[model samples]
Target: MQVVPARRGRAVRLARGQAIRIVNTHGSQVVDTWAFNADDPSEFMSMEHLHASLGSVFPKTGDALYTNRRRPILTLEEDTSPGRHDTVIAACDVHRYRSLGCTEYHDNCTDNLHAALAMIGFPRTETPSPLNLWMNIPVGPDGQITWGEPLSKPGDHVLLRAMIDCVVVMSTCPQDMIPINGANCLPVEVHYEVTG
Candidate 1:
């Protein structure tokens, strides 16, 4: 198991047929996740395309996560949560923090993504809307969305299998302005491991 330290990010390269199991070590940490083709950075996983391909905003186990080119890049092979992963919320960034009234520099998922990729010697690419693992954004009947706490318990995990060779980035979202991580509004580390 590898630790994605609190308010930080990690990246791993997975070949086709391999899977990564991301564990919610503390139960409330929301991991903003993204995947890009190893051979083509422009072909990264896309939330808009995934919503259209799945005909829903929520992805569950057995779902094929699509990329910008409308092709499967990863598969949601296993989920131990309540199937509440979010596909609509954009990853938190400095701009978002500013909007939330932060005047100082804030750590965010957007920067984390770029840094993680760079650690692997990959050039920075456009930030795609991430698959927010364990993020609880409840959509009401009135078409309103409310930020909710995670329904997952400690040790809950989501296993994503790469359909093609790709680099998967995981960010331990640093959104302390909101209670999306938990009622305490604290961001924490999570863990993951690559599996055959």
Candidate 2:
């Protein structure tokens, strides 16, 4: 078990059949997560493939997260804060902050993801869309998405079991411009567990 500080990142390697539990320690915080084949970083989790295969926009227990090659990377085993995650949003980055009227440097999820990957010696590359855990962005009748306060509370967690050996990166989202993190960003914790 490891506690990932607010607006920071962490990386972990999971062997096949291992599992990771992501905790919203402070509640209402968003954690952006990415996964890739441990031996081949180029084959990363794919939001498109996952949605296509599951035929749903939100993740649920029993759903298998797919990789770029349409192979199962991880399976959703438990979701204490169920149905409150996002699979359609990309991680926040510098360009997004700039466009949002920020001129100075701001901590963003993209950099966090890259830093986490670098920690594990993975080369920098284009990041795939993240599986936003504990985020709340609902689509309205007009097909417009609006950010809302996360439904997750303190100590709430979701566990994902790895279907294949993989590298997982996580970013405690630092977006202070929206209500995604209840109007303030904070840290979270992660627990890596291996089962027989």
Predicted structure with the largest TM-score when compared to the true one: 1
Q: Write the per-residue lDDT of candidate 2 for residues 1-196, one digit (tens) a residue.
A: 6767778888888999888888787777888989899888889999999989989888898889999899999998988875689988999999999998999999889999889888889778688999999889897889899888899877788888988899888888888887888865444444434454
Determine which window of 10 residues in candidate 1 has minimal summed lDDT.
115-124
What's the TM-score of each model vs. the native?
0.99, 0.94
Candidate 1 — which residues are off by over 4 angstroms?
Answer: none
Local distance difference test scores for all models? 0.96, 0.85
Tens digits of per-residue lDDT for model 1, 110-143: 9999999999998789999999999999999898
Which 10 consecutive positions of candidate 2 have the poorest summed lDDT? 185-194
Spell out the clash pairs found in candidate 2.
Answer: 6-187
